[model samples]
Target: MKIAIVGTGQVAAALGKGWAARGHMVTFASREPGTERVQQLLADAGPNASAARVADAVGRSSIIVLAVPFTAVRERLEMAGDVGGKVLIDCTNPIAPGLRPMFDATTPGGATSGVEQIAVWAPRARLVKAFNTTGAENMAAPRYNGQPSTMFICGDDEVAKGATAQLAEELGFEVVDAGGLSAARHLENLALLWIHLARVNGMGRDIAFRLLRR
Candidate 1:
């Protein structure tokens, strides 16, 4: 699969490297594609990875990963142009200053989850909410004591969710289909909890969430 990751941050870097290692063509979408940072990122991601302008990358890939900061989501999506039938994986958390959850209470009908708002912004894209409830370190290596970490993903489109699940599995996560896109409300809150546990509670970034069943 070809993936266009729309960010140059830690989470983007981790996912890009993981997918590239799995033999997927990975293109990192960046504002500064020619920068040393981006060049180094491509080198770190191995031979299967490259960097390009956001629109160029999005235009060439079937899967587009929105790994930018929550504040930059709309801007990046606008840069991606018309994403009509492409699979769009959202890996961002609406985190405000002091680690507070930034839910929008005035979004037309009612309060909206970050991913739900994203759906409104890029309505044509096949959207899936994922990679938000864990740290970038976990994305890089999603194993804990020989067990794959849990990855909870939700989306209205089953095919999009399936694609997102496959990408998560490629990163060593045990994926749980958490119903439709509305379930992103819970998943985003879950991401806030993960952030609190890792940052505020002093548990550290090495910790990850898991779902065990019989």
Candidate 2:
């Protein structure tokens, strides 16, 4: 798969490396693709990874991962031109100043959830909610105690969810289908809980959630 990562940050770089290692071409969409920092980051992801302008990157890839900060997502999506038919994966969580939940302020009541709100920004794209619940360290290495950590994903489109699930599994996660786009509310809350546990409670970044069954 040719994956276009819509950010040059840690999360994007980590996922880019993982996907590149898995033999998927990764193109990082950035404002300054000619910069040394962006070039170095792409180089680290391997030879299959490169950098391009936001719109150009999205135009060239089948899968688009929005790994940018929540506040910048809308602007970035707008810059990506018409991304109507692409598999757009939302990997951002609404975190406001002072580590507060930005959803209350930014997300309208009728939007249902952040992912749904994001869908409005990119209405034509098949949006999938994923990769926002854990830290970048956990994203880079999802295994602990010889077991893979669970990655919960949800979307209105089953095909989009399936593609995101396969990508997550390829990166060493136990993918869990967390139902439709409405489930993004709970998933975002889970992300806040994870942030609290890792940062406030000092559980650290090595910890991850696991689902067990009989």
Best by lDDT: 1
- Model 2, 1-214: lDDT tens per residue? 9999999998998899999999999999999999999988977888999999999999999999999888898899889999898999999998766666667534566675678888888888999999998888888999997799999999999999999999999999999999998899888888988999998999888879998979
Alpha-carbon local distance difference test for all models: 0.92, 0.90
Residue-by-residue lDDT tens digits, candidate 1, 64-115: 9999988999999988898999999999998777776677566565547888
Root-mean-square deviation of each candidate, in angstroms?
1.3, 1.6
TM-score of 1: 0.96
Runs with alpha carbons beyond 4 Å of true place in candidate 1: 104-111
Lowest summed lDDT over 10 consecutive residues: which window, candidate 1?
A: 103-112
**Model 2, which residues run further than 4 Å from truth?**
104-109
TM-score of 2: 0.95
The TM-scores, one per candidate, come to: 0.96, 0.95
Backbone clashes counted, model 2: 0
Residue 90's lDDT within candidate 1 is: 94
